[model samples]
Target: MPSLSPPPVDKPSDATTAQTTEAETKPHAQPDSDEPINSLDPQPIDESKPKSNLDLVNECDSFPYFQSTPQLYLNHVSTYYHLRVAAYPEITLGYVLPSVAEVLRGLEEWELDDDERTLTLKAGDDEPTRSAILARTTAAMREIGHFSILKGWRNELYPVYGPAPARDLLFSIERAASALFGIVTYGIHMTAYTKSESGELKIWTPRRSKTKSTYPGMLDNTVAGGMATGENPQICCVREASEEASLPEDLVREKAHSAGTVTYFHIRDSRAGGETRLLQPECQYIFDLEVPSDVEPKPSDDEVEEFYLMGVDELKEKLKAGEFKPNCAVVLLDFFIRHGVLNAQNEPDFIEIVSRLHRKLDFPTA
Candidate 1:
C-alpha cells in the first residue's frame, strides 16, 4: 500500500495551462437542469475542431481546482452555499448554509462557522467512534428520506484525499454529501474483456438494477464498487467481482490486472429537491480482466439487472447513443486507448484524448 502522506502541492505550470486550453474545446455534456440526466452521450466528432479529443476528456473531468476560485458554490433548493478551501483560507471550495452544515455537524469532529459559512474536518480522530457517529447520522437521515440506505448494509468509510492528506477518517458512502465540501473520494472499476476464436474483442457489460438509487437501469462495467476505507484496490476488485458478477475467486485472482486509473470531478443533479450533488475529486482505479471466451458472468447482486457480452464496435455505438454511464464510457475510452483501438493513426484527436484520459489529478498520496 502507498503511504497516505500528501505530496507537495504546486501551481499548474505553463504546459498544464496549454493542455487545459487544448482539452476544453471538445464538446461534453453537462446537466441541463437539476435532473440526474445522463451526460456521457458521445458527441459527433466534428472534423472542423482541431482539438476534439480534449473536449471529450474535459466533459468527464468537470471539477475546477480549489485555487481557481475564491469559493465554490453548492445549490440546495433556491439557496447557494459557498465552500472555501480548507487549507487556503482565502479560497472558497463551495458553499453550504448553516442548517445544512448543522445537519453535517451532528456527526463527530466537523467544524463549521455560521458567520463565514466555512466547514473543516478535524483530523486524527478515533476511527471506530467517528464511524459510529457517522453511521447513526446516516440512519437518521435515511429515516427522514434524505437518501435511501442499502438494506442491512453499514456505511463504508473512505479516506479523505487532498493537498494535505489527513489521517483523520472522512465521510462514508452514505454521507457522500460531505464530499461536495471539498473532499476527494475513490472508487474501483474492472473491465472484463475476452476475444473470440476469430480474434474479435468483446466486453462484458451490466445494466444497473432499476431499484438502484442512482443511475437505475443504466449500463455499467463488468464489476465496479467504491473503495471503502482500509480496503485496497485489489481487495475491492475481488469483492466486487464476486458480489456483482458471481466470478469465482480463483479466476479473478489470476486474471485481474491493474490497468491504470481515471480521475474526474462531476456534479449529479437531483430532481427530488432541485439540488445538485457534487462529486469532488473522484478517482477510479481501473483494472482489466481477460476472461476465457467460454466464461460467462451471472449477476449475483441486486445492483445489476443483467449482463451481456458485446463486441467492441457495438459497445462504441451504444456508448455514443448514451446507453452507458458517463464515467463508464470514460473507462471504456481508456481501454480503447490502451488496446490500440483509438490512436493517432485512426483518431484525429488522439493526443488530446490521451492527455485528457490521463489528466494529472492532485491526489493526497504521492
Candidate 2:
C-alpha cells in the first residue's frame, strides 16, 4: 500500500506578526547624523556541508550548555535564573515559564525576586501540596493559551530523580524545561523482537501518529512514554505497551525484561523565539520483549499509525538512513550494542558513541 501523508497544518501566525510589529516600532538612531542613514543589507550566505551518518549520530548524542556558558550566537541576551532557597546553580529557562512576569502570575507557591531574577518554592511547602499547586498553575496556563495540552490528557507531574535526597516533580510534558532547571526526567522504551520461521531476527517498529506535535510520522520503538507521577518504570512500560501497541497486559507482563537504560542531554532551539533554547536531560528505561513469530502488533491508540516487522538488517539500514526519530535512534543503537550487532571493530567511533550514550547531567542533589 502507498504511504499516507497527512496534510500539513500551519502554525498560528498572530504572535509572530505582533512580535514583528513591536520590533519594527523600536526606535533606531542613526550612527552619525552627518552621514546618510543606510538600510541594513543581508549578508552573503555560506552553503553548509552535508553531514555523514556518523556525524548525525554524534550530533544527536550531545550535552546541554551550562548556565555560565555564553551563547554568543543568540540574537538577544540570555538570562539565567536560580531557586533562591537552594544552593543550586543558575538555570537557563526554556518553555514552562518564559519570563519572570509569567512565573509570578502562574505559580503561587513560587516567590520571585525581581532584582535577582531568582524564584523559590515557598518554605515548608510539602511535596503533595507542591504537586497540587503546580497542577493548578498548569491548568491556568493552558486556559490562557500559554501552554497547549498534548495527547488530550490533563497535565501530569513527573518525578525528577537526583543523587540522594533531592527529589522533585514537574509537569510531564514540561519536563524538557524542568531538565533545563537541572532536573532528570525519566521515561521508558520497549522493543518487541521475534524470530522468523527461517531463523532470522525481526524487530517490530511503529510509525508515530502524525497528530503528535513533536516528531510526527517518525518511526519509533514498539512502545514508549514518559513515566508519569506515581508510576514506576515497569508500570510505565506495561501501560505504554498496551496503549501504543495492542499488546495484552498478560503478554507484556510475562514477556518483557528490563534491558537497562539510555541517558543523554540534548539542546535545541525553542519555539518561543530564535534566541531561546531548550535543554533536555533524560533517561529512558529500556525493556525488551520477545514475541511469538506469528504475533503481530496492531495500533491500539492514536499514538501509533502502523506497526511493521522488519528484518534486523533492514532495521539497521533504515536506522543508518536517518528514518527513525533522533532519540529513538539512540535507543536502537543501545540495543544493537548489547546484542553484539554494533561493536568496536565494526564501527569507527565506537568508544565515543558508547560514552555519549550515557551523559552525566549535573542534577542538583545538594
Candidate 3:
C-alpha cells in the first residue's frame, strides 16, 4: 500500500492519433493543449491551521469558489454535464465536466449528446455488458493516458445505481475513475465508543497507515470502507469492522447499530491522487457500536497504523485542529450531532452544519 504516484502522460504517437473518431472534431471535444480551455478545478482551502467545527464541514463539502456558502455548492453542480446511459433518459447516473467530456471522445463506447448536454455511455441493458464496456473503456483510457486520476485506480469496482427509489444497478466503474465521472459513491463509517463506570464516553479512532496512497497518516473513523458493487451498508460495515479494526463479526453484529447516513459532495485536493478538484459525491452509511470496556480495537490490516481511544473533549480538539480526513471529519460531526454532543446550544452554526452533513445529491443513490 505504498503511496501511488501517477505515471507521467507521454505525448501521443502518430499511431495513437489514428484511433480518434469524428466525435473528436465536435465543438466540445477540443484537443488537448498546453493550457486548459475551461478549468473545472475548485478553489483551494488552507489545511495548515486549526479550523472551527463549521470550517471542518466546509472542507469536505467545499465548492463554489466565489464563497464558502453551502447552498451555492449544490447550485454549482448544475454547471457540469449530466452523465447518463442511452435507455435511462430520466435518471442521471453521474456528472461530467466538459473537460472530461472531451476526453471521453477518445473512447469509442461513449456517445456525446450535444443537445442534451450529456456524455452517455453506449452499452446494452445487462449489468455484465455495461460493466464489461465500462471496464474495457476505462482500461483503454488508462493505457492511453487519458487523465492522471485514472492512474490512482483501484482494480475494485463501484456500482452506479440507476434510480433513487428503485436503486437498480446501472453499471460499475473503477474506484478512482468514479471521481473523474462525478458519480455518487457509497461507503460505510462506524463510530465505536465505550462508557466508563461514571458514564464518561470515549470513542475509538484509527490513524491511516502513512504508506496509504491517499490521505496517508490521517485520522479515520473507527472502521470504514467503500461499499463494493453489490455490497449493502450493513454487510460492508460488518466486513470493514473485521478487516480494518479486527472486530469479530459476531461482536459487530451483536453490538453495532445503524445510525443512518452522512452525505456530502467533496472536491479532491492534492493529497488525493490524480487531478485535484475532481468532484466526489459520497454517502457514508453511519453505524455506532458501544464496545464492551474489555474489547480493544486493533489494526487488522496495513491500512491502519494504530487505534486511539479518545475522550469526547479530546476528539473535539482534534476535529477543530483538522486532524481527521475531510469526509471522516464530516462523519464525526454527524456522530456528534446524533449523540447530542454537538448541540444547538453550544454550536452557533448548528443548523447549517446539520443540513450540509445530509446534503441532497442530484444523482440517484441507494
lDDT of 1 at 133: 48
Q: Decide which is better by lDDT, 1 or 2.
A: 1
- lDDT at 113, model 3: 66
Quick one: best TM-score, which candidate?
A: 3
For model 2, the stretches where C-alpha displacement exceeds 4 angstroms are 1-59, 64-79, 83-102, 105-108, 113-117, 147-153, 161-182, 197-199, 268-276, 364-366
Q: Give the TM-score comparing model 2 with the true structure, all chains together.
A: 0.71
Task: Tell me how many residue pairs clash in candidate 2.
Answer: 0
**lDDT, candidate 1, 1-366, per-residue tens:** 111121232221111011121111211212124432223222323425332334445555654443442122111211323333234343333333333454554334456554433555443345454445445644554454433222324355666432334433433434344443434567789999998778889999999888776657778989988887778899899998999899988889888999988877655434111234444556799999999877889998688888999988788777656566667778888998999888889888787667666655433431
RMSD of each: 10.5, 10.9, 7.6
Model 3 residue 33 distance off true place after TM-score fit, in angstroms = 28
- Model 1 alpha-carbon drift over 4 Å, by segment: 1-59, 65-99, 102-109, 114-117, 122-126, 136-140, 143-154, 161-182, 270-275, 361-366
Ranking 2 against 3 by lDDT, winner: 3
| Candidate 2 local lDDT, 1-366, one digit each (tens) | 111122232221111101111111211212111222121111111215433335545445444233322221111111223333222223322212224233343344566553443455553345555445545544443344432322233345566432345444322334423433434567899989987678777789999888776667878988888887678889998998887788988999988999988887554333212112334557889999999877788998777889999887788777756667767888888888888878988888788778777765444321
Instruction: Give the CA lDDT, 0 to 100, for residue 330 in model 3.
Output: 88
TM-scores for the candidates: 0.69, 0.71, 0.84
In the range 192-224, model 3's lDDT, one tens digit per residue, is 999899989899999999998788998999999
